[model samples]
Target chain A: MLAAARQLLVREGPGAITHQRVAQEAGVGRATAYRHWPQPDQLLLDAMGGADLPLFKDPSAPIRTWLHRQLRQMADELEVRAVAAMALTLAHSALWDPAIAHRQAESVRTIIERILVATRSAVASGELETEISAVDVAAMLVGPIVYRTTMQQGTVADDLIDRLLDSIGTWRD
Target chain B: MLAAARQLLVREGPGAITHQRVAQEAGVGRATAYRHWPQPDQLLLDAMGGADLPLFKDPSAPIRTWLHRQLRQMADELEVRAVAAMALTLAHSALWDPAIAHRQAESVRTIIERILVATRSAVASGELETEISAVDVAAMLVGPIVYRTTMQQGTVADDLIDRLLDSIGTWRD
Candidate 1:
């Protein structure tokens, strides 16, 4: 049932995730699906949390390489139209639903923590801008990709990572 | 009817702007509203296109000042919760609906053209990186504020403009 929910979410955006629709897609009874998830939002939260999109892997790796890899992974993920639309759907849903917002915030906080871990040694060594916060760094790195993929519906260019890094004035190689 | 639709959209997100709800909000007969807009997407597209939220004004102004002013204005606008939610709603809707995507693409193209005009002299004079596209520059400049305001539900700090400019390596002042 959860897999069905995730498939519906990724394929058709959040609007298609009602108990009846999910049950139909999962080949289960409507009453069974409703009993499992009284609210569609709860079903959505679980499906999103369990969706197998990996990001920011190996946070302990060198900062620059780790950052580059993450950006590349994001670009690859967003290249799929379904995945990109799902992201935008989740972002939009997060606005009106506190539960979605909280879940998203938890995931974002985890990613921010990973970014901070990678940047800690660089900041201590004066290699990164000391005044900038981890949140700012995340925004700087991830924001453009989000804008390009979700807003502009454009591909994340190869030069974009270098450009973002250059703009941040960090980890030049 | 359009005014009521805009209000419903800005106040409660896209899901609230059905013909029935909009007719009630506008104190008109539902039949009249349906006659005018047979499809809800038309109403949404019209409302979004006619929204009075100003952005990228005075594009002929000097590049640096104009860019900073635009960013500041965006921060101010997104500071309003409803406005930010509307933006997310539109972004999400644009994915599923081709009409919304077309309207949004027109506006985005206009903004990108404005950015290109502002950067033309700088790019020619080598004051800015010649290799970067205006769309990339726009993404780099605007992405962080969108991230902070919509995704993070955080305020755009005064220092963010400088940090973004620094990241783009254009217009340090």
Candidate 2:
């Protein structure tokens, strides 16, 4: 089960997400686990996809404030074991397989889409102005977070969010 | 040998970087490889570190131009087989071993140090100004590239470099 995969990832790291360990943890036969998820990477992806991090909240707030809060929340979540699994997923994604890399890019696109929806709302609400597309703005916000996390510096500073927004060319209503 | 290790990583992926494969590739006995590296991760680190990346050139040029050229060179190199090998080393680096992670962190620090030197030069020349430390400005430069690379995005946009420098509070001398 995905729960078993996630628990193993959190408790033992990415190497422990074998089908056998997950099946054993979930009280399922090895064949059963393999029948649904063929490779450990598939199970690992499912588990990372299912991590229960907080999401965008306070939609009524100014767009910049809402985004800042969302990023801050994401930073807080990274302090936990979930970040270890996510970090491993992001890092090892380069398996030299185009299929795998495409899948990884698609998954990243999903997160970017989530940010874009809010950014569009910000644009409509007069809290933001930018020459870049919403998609590029999302990259501007999330790119540094991924970078800092990969570097293992363990914190995304408050000013980083400010700078990222400033770089996006935001303006007063 | 490190050459053998790099060959396996470029040809295959991180999963292929074992003592046996490296030894076989290098025309040496497995025992000989083991005597040198002992652990597969150590071999992986050596191979990744040994990649022939282009480094900073023309330090006498304006610091911003020199720094941008360095990032651009790094991006150009990412287009080759070296990226596959480098990506694997970064991704699978989180095999849940603190000792291994610590060792990985130490290796990463070397590269960050290189970026810091250039950024410090930029600051000292008044080509850039920021409340953030030079170490962080380096992160701002490197993070987007890593994020794009990890996502399998083929290019780091030219404007991304521009925006990053802009966000760092760059100014005319």
Candidate 3:
């Protein structure tokens, strides 16, 4: 039911989502849909959070290699265009809603934390030369990817990611 | 007149931008407003292009310094909360409107070109390494600023921009 709601929301938009429509799409009774998710926002939020997506891999991979792979996977799965559109929509909406703003803030923090953990592992093994803080490195990694995806209207191709890895890899001590 | 339209659009949203309201706000006759800008979209586009504002600065400063200043100005002007809201609304609207999408694409491309020109000048002066393309460096400079403003709802503080400059400065051949 939640998945059905998400599909409708993503395909049609937030305005088209409702208990009746979700019930019709999911092949469930209106009463059942209403009982499960009284509000469309709740349903959409659950769908976003409830998906059983793949988790980040072992910290053993080289930091740059791992980051490139992860970013590629995310770009592929989310479809760069869809992610770009959704991100822009959410950004505007976040202004009016404190809850949405908090969620976006938390998500960015998590992405930064994951990058930090990988950087720390690399530092421990003496793979990197610069003793830069994890937060700073995370921002660097994020900058290009977001810029390419959002502003360029295209995915970060593997070749570009490779170039990024190569450039940053040289900083390794 | 353009400034008044923009203020109305920003404060009241795209829907409230009627010729009568804009004329009233700008202290012009409705006939005069219609005569000047026959289409509402044209008026909005002109305002967004900074047509009425003296915002453009001479590119006389060093590229790095100029970029830092521009990013700082964007952060201060947009404000973290306002940027998030604007990004979200624009993102959602663009998905449905081909015209808006095209404008956004062009806007980003123009900004990237401006950055590229600045970076190329720096490279010519032997201040920056020639190995990294100006396009990639421009992406690096803009990506984080947008991400912080739109997703994290945080200011792109001077310290952050300084950190980026410091990192890129180390990439000498």
Q: Interface RMSD (Å), each candidate?
A: 1.0, 2.3, 2.7
Clashing pairs in 1: A167-B167
Q: lDDT by residue for model 3 over A59-116, one digit each (tens)?
A: 5556666777776765553344544555555555566678766776666677777767
Selected candidate, larger TM-score, 2 vs 3: 3
Give lDDT tens digits, candidate 3, residues B1-173.
87887787666544445678989999999999899888654555555644222122344446667767776766564453533444445545667778767767766667666766766777777666645555566666666666666665556668777766654544343
Off by over 4 Å in 2: A1-45, A50-60, A90-103, B1-45, B50-58, B81-85, B94-103
**lDDT to native, each model:** 0.74, 0.66, 0.62
After superposition, which runs of candidate 1 have C-alpha atoms over 4 Å from their true positions? A1-45, A50-54, A125-130, B1-46, B51-54, B124-130, B170-173
Better of 2 and 3 by DockQ: 3
After TM-score superposition, what is the CA distance of residue B115 in candidate 3 from its true location, in Å?
1.7
TM-score of 3: 0.69
Candidate achieving the largest lDDT:
1
lDDT score at residue B26, model 2, on the 0-100 scale: 93
| Clash pairs detected, candidate 2 | A91-B91, A92-B91
Docking class of 2: acceptable
Assess candidate 1 and give its lDDT.
Answer: 0.74
- Candidates 1 and 3 compared by TM-score, better number: 1
**Model 1 Cα lDDT, one tens digit per residue, A23-104:** 9999999999989988554666577776543466456435666678778777766766666776777777787688777778
Model 2: per-residue Cα lDDT over B81-169, one tens digit each? 44534554654654566755665676556566766676667778887676776556666776666666655365777777777667777
lDDT of 1 at B149: 84
True-structure RMSD for candidate 2: 7.5
